[model samples]
Target: MSLRRLLRTDAAALIAAHRASVALHRSWVTPCLDQAGFEAWFSRTLAEDYLSLIALERGSGAVVGVFNASQISRGNFLSAYLGYYACVPYAGRGLMREALPQAIAYLFGEIGLHRIEANIQPGNAASIALARGAGFRLEGFSPRYLRIDGVWQDHERWALLADEAGF
Candidate 1:
């Protein structure tokens, strides 16, 4: 698989991937399923401290998933919050497990970020495992930390520092 910055031309493929993976991402994330939402999301990525990257299958160039790094703070903070989800055909293949660290390396090495954080819902085992396997430590928990699927959800905070990533 290959990972790269999301492009405007990828709208159709990305929306199709999101539409196909609705069941898999039900309780975890709600990616843009239409052109309007995709446009808004794409707009957000154009902001100063937010970025979105798309992962693709090498041969077919099919979108495997998307990773977003947002709320980046520079200066002494040097950190960002991460969000990601895998598409239907690619969900259980260990592909995200491989690509996440590469994304982190880019954030740390190329973007000069010192920390990256992932907030996961308590009941999502797959997401938790992905975060853990990527070297994120269990930092803490927050009640009603985020609203997902129209309800307030609790979350476990996980983080990885640049030094801890063994760059």
Candidate 2:
């Protein structure tokens, strides 16, 4: 699979992929984020210059996953937060193992970001594993860090620094 920047033309495919991903993680993801919300969110990200990417099957052009990184500034820190999901069909295929490093490299090298973080639901083993595989170190846990599936959930924070990773 290859990763590419999300395009306006990819809206329909992204919606379909989003729905499939939601279904797969319905117990964790809020169902209220419907198609309209997805479109609007994507638009807002585009306007904010966030890097949103889609993983595509190289041969068939099928969208297999979506990933996003948004630059954030707080006090003296300038960093980015990472979010991603792989469609069920693409899970366990090592696609993220390939995509994430590229994304991180781009964030640090091209975007000039110093750090990237992943806030993963505590019980989401797949995501935690993915973050570790991508060389992010688990920092600590946050209680009631986010609302998932309409309920407050705890999250494990993980981070990677560009200098540390030598990227």
Judged by TM-score, which candidate is best? 1
Task: Encode model 2's per-residue lDDT on 60-149: one tens digit a residue.
Answer: 888777778866543457588888777767877888777777777777887777888999998788889999987899999999988876
* Candidate 1 runs further than 4 Å off: none
Model 2: lowest-lDDT 10 consecutive positions: 25-34
- Candidate 1 local lDDT, 1-167, one digit each (tens): 78899889999999999999999989788899999989999999899799998989888998889999999999999999999989989999998887887799889998999999999998989889999998999999999999998989999999999999985
Lowest-scoring 10 consecutive residues by lDDT in candidate 1?
96-105
Provide the clashing-pair count of each candidate structure: 0, 0
What are the RMSDs of all candidates, in order? 0.8, 2.3
**lDDT of each candidate versus the true structure:** 0.92, 0.77
